[model samples]
Target: MTRLQPLPGGLPERFHVAHAMEKGASRTRLRASDLSAPFHGVRSLSLGEADTILDRCRSYVPRLAPGQFFSHETVFVLRGLSTPEWPYVPRIHVSAHRPAREPRTHGVVGHRLQTREPAIDVGPEGMPIENAVRAWRQCGRLWGLDDLVAGADALLAGRHPIASLGDLEEEVALMGDVRGGILRRSLALARPGVRSPRETHLRLLLVRRGFPEPDVNVDIFSTRGEFVAEIDLAFAAWRVAVEYDGRVHAEDPRQFARDADRWAAIRDAGWDHVRILNHHLRGGGAPAVAMVRAALIRAGWRPGL
Candidate 1:
């Protein structure tokens, strides 16, 4: 048996077999036990090593046909938006500019674009992908109203937004025949400065249960105009803040300490703060909503007033 040379570290996690052959790897070596054939003519050292959905998608980019760009959940992954876990869909999504036969490949889902739709762009990793707003609209086919709102909020968040709410609304108007009700509802519910999907979920739970929609990631200041803290969701007048604590807060010692201090400061400022954990958000968010509702009542918020 011929000895195989070790793969170079400079090589991407996934590469074409031809590239490997060019780098002096023999066909027999490319087919070694350590290599995986993720797509036709594409090889990976370890499929498990491609931990993220985007990593797995990038592995197959060299094999994508002409005029193809990622869309739907795949684009969600590419744009760094929140997405479902691997095996949720278990297929890479591709969208072609023109009508084409659905790819017969077992692990791929293909879509056709409408005429005169926005042009696709090459993403940071050189993979072809739809723009953020367009991709958010495309995702409506797969995601429900709440998930879509979360996606839109992510797209239009922070000082440097990838896409604006108006841009998303225009895309929805252009794609008239797709996901009508869910798209409109998501657009109405979507707000800027939402940092994560869990925040969006918590906000939706409150509003859906008839609580006045709280502002997203608003800053609360001390009486002397010093910034006390920026809260996840706040009913400013009511002085109630609803915060979603992801696992990172507990896992990172420094963050946990900072959060404790921040909570104490907010409490000292005469604001009622509600901390929401992942478990409180499960099911219908009854416990979390009840907690926020109680805080709101204490802060002088009434349902019909």
Candidate 2:
């Protein structure tokens, strides 16, 4: 028995089948078990690339038409935004504008949108996607108030920011009661400078309990003008700092030590520190809210003020 001829060396890991055929590849060689078809007429090397959402999107790029681009939570995942995973299940998203039909590919979900260029951002690798602001607006139709605000806060977050708070506000202002005004409502609750979605959840939990909105990622300073640390949420007037303590800090020895030192310094600076955990966020977040309220009271915050 004779072995099949290998594909041309110049071909990429993921390439159009027609392109590979045009590049001096025989039909039999292209049908081999080594390559997997991620989309019709597209083949990937079938490595670990299929394991992630971003890789799956890239694999489908060859099938993307001129009017179609990525949208919703798919673009969020592609761009590394912290969106809920539920929205991304079952099928990858493909989008187009008015008058043009959305994609109908297998393993793809089509979205007919009211968006075009300028609102569409072509990323570094040349993958066209809805800009972060427009995607946030589109997401309003899918996410609830908490997930919506959390996604926006991530875009406006000081670290790895995709857009500014002003960017979100501008998009929301133009939406004009779309999705029954959830865009505007989420914007009213969302804050800039939050570090993570967990921090956003903590802030919203406090505000929902009628606690005053705390500053997100506030910097602490000693009287000597030295920076202490950037606490997750801070009540500047009340001198209360609340932080979300995830498992990473507890499981990693070095990170745990640094967190300990940071918490100690905040206390030494005469501030009340509240540490919130995942359990506190469950069951309506009453426990975490109570903890923050106690810290506020310790710093002289009175009820009905």
Candidate 3:
């Protein structure tokens, strides 16, 4: 038996078998028990547990052909968009130009395109990937209106946005019912400055219940014009704010202290603040909606006013 050579540095987590051969590993050693064969010609010594969808994707990189970009749910994971955990598909999604031949692999979803190639961008691994906006459009075929809105908000949020709402609108117009108009309604609901999917869900719940849509992540100023703090969802005119307290708030000590101080400042500024938890959303958001509604009413908001 030949002695196996050490792997070279700077290789990705998963690499082609040829790369190992270049590093002085014999084909026999490459098939040794220490290495795992993720794809036909790809081998890795440390293929971490394939628990999450992303963990599985790392194993499929070698099989991703040139001119093919990751799309659908795979792109959602790559872009860090919030999605449900269940319904995990082991198959990887690949998109390519017309005359696309679906790979013979059993666990891969191939999309052959007749229209002009969807816009392409590079992912974290420097591999060709579908741009965020185009990926969101592709996702419309699978996700519901609320989930799509959350995804759009994620794309358009933060200082360095992946894509603008205008960019998404343009893409939707170009698609024009190709996806059965799934993205059209979500486009209307999508807004900027939303920080998380839960926040988006809260906003959608309020609007669906006939409450005036609240502003997202707006800064509150004291009566003296000093900036108080930025609240998650606010009705500036009504001096009402709504916040979603996810597990991180209570689990992280630093965040817990910061949140306490921020809420105190908001209260000192004479604004009504409503804190929502995962439980509030679980029961169809009735408790949260009723709470926000009462606060809005007290602040002089009225229906059809």
lDDT of 2 by residue, 1-305 (tens): 66768788888788988888888887777778788888788888874548777778889888787788888877777777768634445247888998778988788889987654446788538899887788888787777878888998888876567888788888777765567788888888878788788888888878878888888888898767789998898899999989998877577899889878888988888789899999998878888988988888888898779
What ordering of candidates by TM-score runs from best to worst?
2, 1, 3
Q: Model 3: clashing residue pairs?
A: none
- Alpha-carbon lDDT, every model: 0.80, 0.81, 0.80
User: After aligning candidate 3 to the native by TM-score, how far in Å is the CA of 143 from where it should be?
Assistant: 0.7
Number of the top candidate by TM-score?
2
Which model, 2 or 3, shows the larger lDDT? Answer: 2
- Name model 2 segments beyond 4 Å from true: 24-28, 47-49, 85-91, 98-101, 159-161
Indicate the worst ten consecutive residues by lDDT in candidate 1.
82-91
Q: Evaluate model 2: give its lDDT.
A: 0.81
The sequence of per-residue lDDT tens digits that candidate 1 reaches over residues 244-273 is: 988685778998898889899888877898
Candidate 3 lDDT over 1-305, as tens digits, reads 76565666666677888876787767877777777776678877684555655666677777777667787767878777766434634246778876665455655677876558557887756766787788788787777778888889989899988888889999888876445576878888989889999999999999999988888999888889999988899988888999998867587899889888888999999999899888888768898888898999999999878
**C-alpha positional error of residue 225 in candidate 1 after TM-score superposition, expressed in Å:** 2.3
